[model samples]
Target: MSKKLIDSGNNAAAMAVQLAEAEVIAAYPITPQTPLTEKLSEVIAAGKMDAEYVAVESEHSALAVCIGAASAGSRAFTATSSNGLLYMSEQLHWAAGSRLPLVMCVVNRGIGAPWSVWNDHQDAMSQRDAGWIQIFAKDHQEIVDMTLKAFRLAELVHIPVMVNYDGYYLSHTYMPFELPEAKAVQEFLPPYDYAHTLDPEKPESLNTVTLPYARLDINGVKRPGYMDIRHNLHQEMRLAMEVWEEIDADYAQRFGRGGAPILDPYCCDDADFVVVAMGSIANQFHVVVDRLREEEGLKVGVLALQIYRPFPTAKIAEALQNAKGVMVYEKGLSYGNQGALYADLKSALYPYPNRPQLHNFIVGLGGRDIPTEDLFQTLKTACLNGDRNSPEQADTPQWIGLQL
Candidate 1:
């Protein structure tokens, strides 16, 4: 039987990690993410969990340790935020390129220069091209469910997975969520069995230097070159979209929780305007959508993205093809360019003949408060006066909650 309890998101993640039976956990403390690792340590100390907790010196060494553990066919895990994630940049590429099945929780935070520890997506967004699968959670319930699904997804595709949630917003806030039985979770997720384990008896080089062209090995068997290997990784990531859908369907059947694997749509059918976002901000829009429909009589809805890395281009286009307008609210941007999701949405709908007019709004950087009134007003204006023919105006991103 499942138990419902009120707890912080960090504790929810820690509980999920224990339930998943992760063998090795190597982590360093960083704001908002520190409590999660600390909770795991306490659980292990109290004899509630049987696992190896390796305390590392820096974020770089944290990921390096996970890499080493995962290579030896162990289910490895880790967590970090902001600069800590940036410090593990080199290891991030190494883990993905080597095809190690590792799962990590990234409590999203803003990058430092001005030095503020707050909620934002800039840290995870900056690492979008690192070849790791990324999933964002909107609440504490998802923080637990997604973390469990992440481990299975990573092992299935042999790629690292990053489960992202906003710092202090979902991380520090307490909410009630169901924690599933350990027996059910164990049945849902089997033991870790990697195909290629680093065995001393059968010595072989892993992730060695590759030539520009294919070469014949000692047994006269053909081997792929550097470019070919990278292309294969890209193909596997694309296939992972369907793989995740299957895993989510099976999980829902067993635990009665997860059906929508790719995107979660709220009152979107027969709506004229749609709001697109990720993480906790998407949940906030549910309130805005209700207000717009009840008070303003606008047919507005929301589409929350669950998977970010694989892009889900075809599914995204199918969902928004008939809408009149789409407003994308994001917490991170591409510096001089517009919001990353906005750019990707435009690309997704480019092929369709009757595409929706798209607009981008950047909000809640460095833990700035995004009032529901601001969201309602901005979306209200877009529905009333959004330009359908002006492509240039739609391309520019407008900043919300900015003080000058």
Candidate 2:
């Protein structure tokens, strides 16, 4: 039987990692993310989890260690946040390019320079092109479930997977969840069987530098060059979409809960207006949608995106096709432009004949709390102001609750 427990999102994530039976864990201390790795370390010290925990000095080294472990055919785990994620940028690309089936948790936080240890999507959004499959969780339960499924999906495609949850939002929020048994999790997620790995008996070179042009080796075998390597990576990522769906379906069968691998639509059908967002913020919109529908009799709905890296263009467009307007709420801005979520969503709806009145409201930056009243009021204003005829009105992102 599944156990009911009250715990923070970070604790849930660590417990999920434990249940997944990770062979190795290497992480650096960074706020928001620090609690996650710290919990894992405590479990390791207590001899509860059978894993090699590496105390790394830096985020780059932490991921580098995970890369090495994954290459050696070990299922590895790690966690990081904010600038720590940026510091591991070089290794992030390396892990994805090498096709290491590693799973890492990103506690979403605002990037530094202004130096704020707060919540935002800027950190993960900046690394969207890094070739890793990124999935954002809306709540504590999804965070645990997604982290477990991440390992399965990553191993299936031999591509690294990032299970992202909002910093201080889901990461710090305490909630009740029915925890899955370790035995059941093991059954759902079989031992990771890497197709190709470092073996001592049969030595093989991996990730060797290649010239720009394709080349024929000494054995007269045609080898793909640099361009081919990158092209294959892109193709593999495209394949991950299908694999992700399969994994989510299987997980639902075992756990009695289905995770929204691509997009989570809330009361979208028969609704004229839809609010689109990601992470924990999207979860809040669900409640708002319910209240608006109940109290004001508005046809407002929510389409929360779970997968960000793949962009889920078709799924998102299909979900919003009937809506008269779309309000994109984001915690991160593109700096001098609009929010990244708004930009991608706009491009997705461009080819459609009857596109909605799209509006982007940038909000909740640097850990700003968005109360229910603020959300309802802001969205009410959006619904009133959004005009499909006045396209220029929705062209740029509008800052919400900005003191300026």
Candidate 3:
């Protein structure tokens, strides 16, 4: 049985990490993410979780520590946000390329320039191609569920997994969540049995320098080069998409709770227009979807992207098959182009016949509050305009909730 508790998203995530029985947790403090690591420290000190909690000087060292632990055959974990994540950028690629089954919680926050410690996806989105499998949580329940599942998923694919949740929106906000039993979680996620690990007796070179061209090992056998190694990472990600679905299904069978782990659809079966969003904004869109459908009888729905890394192209195209228009709401934007997600979604649907009219809105940067009514109104206007066959009337990549 699970116990219900009202706690912040950080607590829920930290609890999940403990339940997953991570052996080593090395993290550096950052806004909205600090609480999570702090809680982990408390758990370790209190003897509730038996793990080595390392206090690192920086986020880079934090992930470096996790990589070292994982390489030594341990279930390693870490968490960070915004600039902290960027500071660990080099190690991020290292952990993924080295094929370490390390699980991390990235509390998504806006990036700096004119600095702000607020919420947005610029942090996580910026690291999209860093070779790690990225999964976003819609609410607190998912914060716990996905974190536990991340450990399982990462170990299965021998790839790193970053579990992302909105910073203040989800990380700092408190909600009632069910805490799963530790015994059950342990049963669900078995011991981390890595195929390869740094062993003294059974010695083998790991992460040795490989040139771009193919090379031969000491035994004169063909060995994969750098490019080949990178290609293998891509292949693992594609295979991970299938693995993620299976894991979610198995988890649902055990816990009686699970949804589409990638691209969750709400009232999208026969809808004419569908809103595409990620993270907490996806949860907000659910309210707007309900209001439009009930009050105005608008055939509008929402597609919340849960897994962004593998880029569920086929699932997205299938979900939007009957829709006449697709609108994407992004908390981050790509300079000189559209939003990252907007561009990706456009590409995903591009190959389909009679693709729906698409639009993108950049919203809620630096902790700016978005009015619910205004959001609904803007979407309704866009849908109405698209209905009039005026999809190309204005230049796209529009900015919403901006004060002139």
Candidate 4:
């Protein structure tokens, strides 16, 4: 039987990495993610986990070390936050471009200039085009589950996976979860078996710039001008979508775990109005949905985000089949537009027959607490007005729970 214990999200992530059977862990300490590294080290020191914890001097070297290990055909794990992730930015491209399967946890935080440590998606969004597959967790359980499941998906598809959760929100939040048996996990996740790995006898080169031909090559065919590495990365990422779905299916079958399962749908099946959000800020929307139904009988649903980089807008459209209105309760604003995920969502609904009024409700910036009641009132007001120009109108992002 699995044991239930109260632990922080970072601890849960460390446990997931342990269950994933990572052969090597290369990491640098960063706030909101330091607890995870500390736990990994404790387990390593106690001989509880049979993995190597690489003490890198910086985030770049941390990921560089993970790349070396993964390229050597070993399962690897790592964690970073904010500037730490930015430091390892170049290697992030290299890991994915080389088709090395590695799993890393990103404790989502704001990028530095003023150097404030708070939860935000800006850090990850800046690297949105990075060849890595980014997956977000709704809560503590999903945080742990996704972290372990990420390795399975990454290794199977030869892609790097970013198991992302809120900085202090999920990273520091405490919750009870059943620990999966190590042996059971071993049975589910096979050892690393992939191509282009560094070997003694079967030595091979990966991600090398070969003179000029490599610059202008289209699938090995020399084309015109400019090195289109980004284009090639895009193509590979498109292919990865299919690969990711397959992995998720197999993982579900082997592990027998489901939440909203892959994606959480509150009342999208029959409702006309919908609210979408990700991470812990998303849960507040659920209570609001329930109250809307029980008190006013308003037909509003909540769609919690599980994966971000993939941007499940098609699924959202399908889920919102008869929906007449939509409100995107975005926590982290994308500077100018205010609403970060709104544009991608709009693009997804562009071809839909009944394109409902979508409101980009920005809330909980700078680690501000979002109360359920406030979100309920905000949704009610936004939906009533059918705020068509919400992306442009409204006070930039819909601020909630603020005194000023």
Highest lDDT model number: 1
Summarize candidate 4's per-residue lDDT along 271-361 as a digit string, tens digits. 8788877777777677888888888778888888777766666776777668887788876666776566776777788887877777777
Once fitted onto the true fold, the runs of candidate 1 whose alpha carbons sit more than 4 angstroms away are none
lDDT against true structure, model 1: 0.93
Among the numbered candidates, top TM-score falls to 1
TM-score of 4: 0.91
* lDDT-superior candidate, 2 or 3: 3
* Model 3: how far residue 50 lies from native, Å: 0.3
Task: State every prediction's TM-score relative to the real structure.
Answer: 0.99, 0.97, 0.97, 0.91
lDDT of 2 by residue, 1-404 (tens): 88889999999999999999999999999999999999999999999999999999999999999999999889999999999999999999999999999999999999988998999889999999999999999888998899998999899888899999999888988998878998999898898777678998867788887899999998999999899989998888887888899888998988888867798888988888999999988888877888888887889988888998777777788788898889999988788888999999989988877588888988888887788777887777677667733667677787777776
Instruction: Using TM-score as the measure, name the better of candidate 2 and candidate 4.
Output: 2
When sorted by lDDT, best at the front, the candidate numbers are 1, 3, 2, 4
Clashing pairs in 2: none
lDDT of 4 at 339: 68
Residue-by-residue lDDT tens digits, candidate 1, 371-403: 999999999999999985377887789999899
Superposition error at 248 for model 2 (Å): 0.9
Once all C-alphas are superposed, what RMSD does model 3 give against the true structure? 1.3
List the global CA lDDT of all models. Answer: 0.93, 0.89, 0.91, 0.79
Off by over 4 Å in 2: none
